[model samples]
Target: MKTAVLITIGDEILSGNTVDTNSNFIATQLKEIGIKVLSIFTIPDEESAIIATLKKAFGMADVVFTTGGLGPTKDDITKKAYADFFEDEMVFSDEVYEHLRTYLEKRNRLWILDHNRDQAMVLSKAKIFLNFYGTAPCMILEKNGVYCFSLPGVPYEVKPLVKDQIIPFLKEKLALDSIVTRIVSVVDIPESILSETIEEWELALPKHISLSYLPIGSRVKLRLTGTGKSRTILEKELDSEIQKLIPLIGENIIATHEDKIEKILGELLIGKKLTISVAESCTGGELAHLITSVAGSSAYFLGGIVTYATQKKIDILNVNPRTVEDFTVVSEQVATEMATGCQSLFKTDIAVSTTGVAGPGRGEDGKDVGTVFYTVRIEGGEVTSKLFLPHLERLDFMNFVSQKILQDIVSLLIKKNKSPQLY
Candidate 1:
């Protein structure tokens, strides 16, 4: 199959003021549809450069994608570039102008002028794509079996337009085969160990199934993509292979999709109409903040505590100072107590807590940095302390600990869901 070329138009990109994220993003999306991105080019908002690149891209690739220069700003020059290439007059469309007017009117700044009018111009024969997020209408020009697409440069605008509209159209037009993808999330485990253990299984994968690892924050995601005529056969092979490789580190699997642990917890709590609370130490209020970041959180989140200082842990969460002294600050006992205390304080069905060393340096007890501990307490589920990394700087440790805690909470929720009440 022929490949697609992604062209990013911007003076800012050449100057390095803004990264060319659209190219990478488009490449990923294209790959999902079994389309290959042959080359990516970024140029200043100059007409000659853009025209030259477009001509080359149209010849070299099956389709050409241009983003970033279709905005209302003066720096955006894609409008004239499209007008010049199509050999057509540029006229403002009432439909696009209404959209642009509404865009500025919502923000209360609708002023009809050349700049705004220019942003609304489209080729008479071009396919118009509405922008759900921005005013720059995407134009698709087709000629002699070549496709050229232009979109707003901004990530927020370009991403949705391309994802929701452009990709689907391309898929249908190309008669591309359906893509089957399998994803798995693993937490409380490093990518290195998982990779090392899964080496053999990975090698056994068929040529159609390609594996890629995307490690974001503290979690590692394994995504397997397979392109073929038989999706069922591929999915079975993928699921069986995933299961076979999983037993080596089954305890660390978070969920199959890209959802974070906190997100998984939110879904569980909301589905069951359960509520949760958190207590924190070295991880800060990040655990609570993570839970609240989701929509409809007020329905499931009772509350939480920061308790950065030991006194607050003792006074607010009722953490026994003796336990803190006996096991030191970053101990399993303290983590358990914190979880239980928050569960009681919030009076919710579930609660999670963290007490650990997130450190740029060693702790007061000379313990190595990143000595983190997590505890999860559900009404009848386990109250267990799981230790993760033992050495990382403060920021890394905080991020790692929060991820571990979230994973623990999710595991407990899953376990609780499986087991019926003994009462």
Candidate 2:
């Protein structure tokens, strides 16, 4: 088993201007290659500071990953620090200089095109990673039988290089097996109930496996991880564990594979040739956004209505004004009416609606914050509405309400066999 350490090099992270997401990204990729992360450090991108941290990191782990400070900025100092720490000579390389020249010419930053080439040369004898994104390239240097890689700070560049390049390289060189993590997402149940319900299964989990509870808003995901094995073996064990747990949790499972509910809905609607629409209020346009996020959604998503205000709910979605004044917009009567109204208006096969008091504030009848209503009307087939109470702040209340509507649509599709529904 190899131990890994991540060093995030930036002053901005230390100053709290930017979060240090690079280290976690690196660690996650490393874990997939069976490299256990032993420690993580966020340090100033100063020559001495980085060198000292690298020394400590090398002592604790087999592979060290350092990100940030690898751009063509004066404050970016990773390249200098690594060269000094390794006692490696800094020499101009024709290959790196040429790369910088062409890249700058293409981007048309002619002001310092030649100077930028000079800035990009890696430490003499160090293997260079031609960063496809920025001027300061990632570099790798080996010393005393340990491995170190310096990577770019930009997320788009670092993510692919680390996940696709760095981890695969290490796996091959070190003869490491892939580590895999699987997620089972569930909804409509609070975390406390979920914890108590699965306490025994959790305690009985194997030493080779770890079950982590990730509760985000109204949903709870069970993440199962198995490290230090081939991907097939890890997946087999994970599947077995999830199968055993599923029967126990029964109807609580919403979906497998950790994907969002909207994604699940999109697939189902597209596959079944089922068109859909949305009538929304408290959740604003959240349901529509979730559906559209999946490409090819245009096939099934005809259009929808946004009835946030009382007049729009009445005139647009045809929710009767009396319904809002009587049972209120957040009530089940209004929810059902909104779904039916939108389904008819859009002429789609289904309509999902949301109306509620997403409040740290008050509603028509002083409905509490987090009071949400979700409805799914499957085009002249059936209408289902449920009162949803998601844990959320009033200002961000629409987020949870929006998410709940998406979730319900997926749930209906699965039940109808357009998609496979979980418990």
Candidate 3:
């Protein structure tokens, strides 16, 4: 496989003001054509930093990709840095200047700043790839069989250049193969124990196949990647290897693709022709947000209620006042009541609830910061409740709790579908 290195340049990215999503996007697209990204470097817009990183990237991989610092600003020094590093001079390109002029004219802009005009500067020895999406042109420089591509930092511009130009150019220039990947999502098992249980199966994988473990919250995704001359053969092998995991792990496996818990839950609901609703407290309707994020969720997701205050839980979800008085707000009794109330309110086939103390501080009941309780209720059937201590910050805590609620509901549905007894 051809290897590539990505360099993302910007002070904002280093200072946490901006995210470097370009590298991930580029790497995914390149992987489809059999190129693998070896490393990624994020640095400030200083010329020296850019030069040093470029030198290192060229030395490490056969191809280098850079995004950022291409705009017409004082801090945009990537062009000069590349020229200086290559011991070449910046030459004006009439073709690029005329393209810029036409671009500005179509937008009816009469005034052209010198900085904007200066975007036509090109390294004399580099091959230019004209950017129709932006003023700054994309350029490729080759040294000792290593190719370095410089592209605009703006996401919109980077997207067009990579999809329309960079990828095609590289595919034609190099003999590349097809790379295929499959994801097997597992839950109900801790990552360490899951690894140990599957250690033998993992060791038996084919020579061309590699496995990576990506853990998120209570779930771990086993990603199997394979490279070969034919995508069909690669996919078949990956699928066959994934099938071996089913008998080994059984229902601990949630999906054969990388899907969000809410999405998987939505599919299950749709498949079973069931409708659902939610009642939330500390999670604050985040469960609703996740459910509705799926494209066709409205068919199964009836609605949600956020009852942060105890009185609202009583007045809206009709949780018994005595239940909260006896077991407190973040208790299993209240969670069960909330789920029951949501089922009655939405008249849905299933309902779920979240009552938690997700915080930097304890709740009114003096429960720990990470204390959480959840309940899933099937209409006219069973009600299940559980407790989880995620111990995460506010946002992460909310996200994890929402996923847990969906996962619980899915597990309930799976059990109900497989059991001899309806209840």
TM-score of 2: 0.84
User: In terms of lDDT, which candidate is stronger, 1 or 3?
Assistant: 3
- Each candidate: RMSD: 5.1, 3.5, 3.3
- Global lDDT of each model? 0.79, 0.78, 0.86
Q: Candidate 3 residues 4-116, lDDT tens each?
A: 99999999999998888899899999998999999999999999999999989988998899999988888899999998898899999998888888888788773773549
For residues 1-423, could you state the per-residue lDDT of candidate 2 as single tens digits? 788888888888999999878777787777767888998888987889899999999888889889888666688878888878898877888877778777777898766885576566678877776766667666777887788998877787898777666776787778675678887888778888889988898888788889888876677878888875578887888888888888777577776675676776776677678998888787777778877888888998998767878788888888888888888777888888888888888888888887777765677777776677777878566656565465666546666667666776666666666336453
In candidate 3, list every pair of residues with a backbone clash.
Answer: none
lDDT of 1: 0.79
TM-score result, candidate 1: 0.74
TM-score of 3: 0.89
Q: In candidate 3, where is summed lDDT lowest over 10 consecutive residues?
A: 414-423
List TM-score per model, in order. Answer: 0.74, 0.84, 0.89
Candidate numbers, best lDDT first, in rank order: 3, 1, 2
